[model samples]
Target: PVKDSTAAIGLTILLFIIPSKLDFLHAFDKDPTKRPTKPAPALITWKTIHEKMHWSLLFVLGGGFAIATGSTDSGLSTMLGESLSGLKGLNEIMILFIVCLFAENITELTANVAVANIILPVLAEM
Candidate 1:
């Protein structure tokens, strides 16, 4: 229904803000049928925020970025690109299949972003 990017942003902002104003956290109460009668305490407490955050995911994302940067700096992406250049004459669907198969296998071995960083340059060169 959103006609433009600005409307989409506005709708997203409204979705986020309206729920807090309406005591959305009450849905987490132990008794599902009973509505919370009292005003909810501050939702953004340090403990709550810390518990909700994925610390492990942060480390993985950081590692992925580091790997991407290292690969680019070491010309690894370029080397990979050159190696795959032989497949340039393949049919589009076949190329797509090969790329998907390669991506799936590589992603199983490492983080997806890392595999993407390593493979995107190769695809671009091709």
Candidate 2:
């Protein structure tokens, strides 16, 4: 949050001075023998490059299709429809805000798969 240069400098000084007297803690000390003998040579291989390119595209396409499939399921659609019914009594804007808040809260506590599975059937029923 240090915005201005002067304020940032002052904060930096304060932080460093306050921490100067504290002892430093570390998980482990370095071992010289374990260090690599030479800098690793730059990798240059068609197979390695091809594998990375291949898998990246494969996984991306696979995940995209899986998400699309999950969203359009009939039971899930029906459940969502049921839950979304009966909005006639409430203001549309307020309803949207409330629904967004509720959904955010729910998503925070549940995984995507669990949330989708639970809501899909319920929505379809609507």
Candidate 3:
């Protein structure tokens, strides 16, 4: 909602600071005996990175990028576009509608960024 760039930056900084301050406050106990005696775990420790993180999503994203790059490099997308070029004769509105439908379906199968990377170049060539 902030219109000024400086105001937006200040708001973002505050957003991060406020939650962190609150969390730090909550970390201490009213009874000294109940408080943590040792330092907290490091942010980038192997336990945090390997055990806590969900890594499957990263693999899926990497696969999507690989598929996009392969399709482009192999010229499969260009061939696909040329094969579908007959659709160019249709009304512009209909073409838009069909492309949107195709995109929606493709996104259901894979990540949207991957689909866009693969489809946009083909559409551009067409």
Candidate 4:
């Protein structure tokens, strides 16, 4: 292969010129113990990782889903849809744009996934 030949020629040139001109290989081997070493960081164990992580993520997600269901079932979403539809003779596109803005604002106030979980079901009902 052309790649292998090129690499072989390059290595041959390096071996000849470097050892003959500067002798770098001899100098590097003359001192080995004088190099500095960095200490390794402590490894994480399963027990430590489990202890450090809070398990409330499941509860938060489940609660968000429940809240979404309740909000939809109570006709809040329908009211929101009707109210927004009255905004200066809003069309579908304008209503969608406003909804997107409100959705972004809610996501900024709360965590994004949690807000999305709540919003998606409500949006579907609307």
Best model per lDDT: 1
Query: Which of the two, 3 or 4, has more lDDT?
Result: 3
Q: What are the lDDT figures for the candidates, one per model?
A: 0.77, 0.55, 0.74, 0.61
lDDT for model 2: 0.55
Clashes of each: 0, 13, 0, 0
lDDT of 4 by residue, 74-106 (tens): 876556656654554667688679878988888
State the TM-score for model 2.
0.33
Clash pairs for candidate 1: none
Please rank every candidate by TM-score, starting with the best. Answer: 1, 3, 4, 2
lDDT of 2 at 31: 61
Error of 4 at 38 (Å): 43
Best by TM-score: 1
Deviation (Å) of 87 in candidate 1: 0.7
Writing each residue's lDDT as its tens digit, candidate 1 over 38-61 gives: 665442445665789899897888
Kindly list the per-residue Cα lDDT of model 2 for residues 28-60, writing each as its tens digit.
328655555544333333454566667856575
In model 3, what is the error at residue 29, expressed in angstroms? 33
Once fitted onto the true fold, the runs of candidate 2 whose alpha carbons sit more than 4 angstroms away are 1-68, 106-126
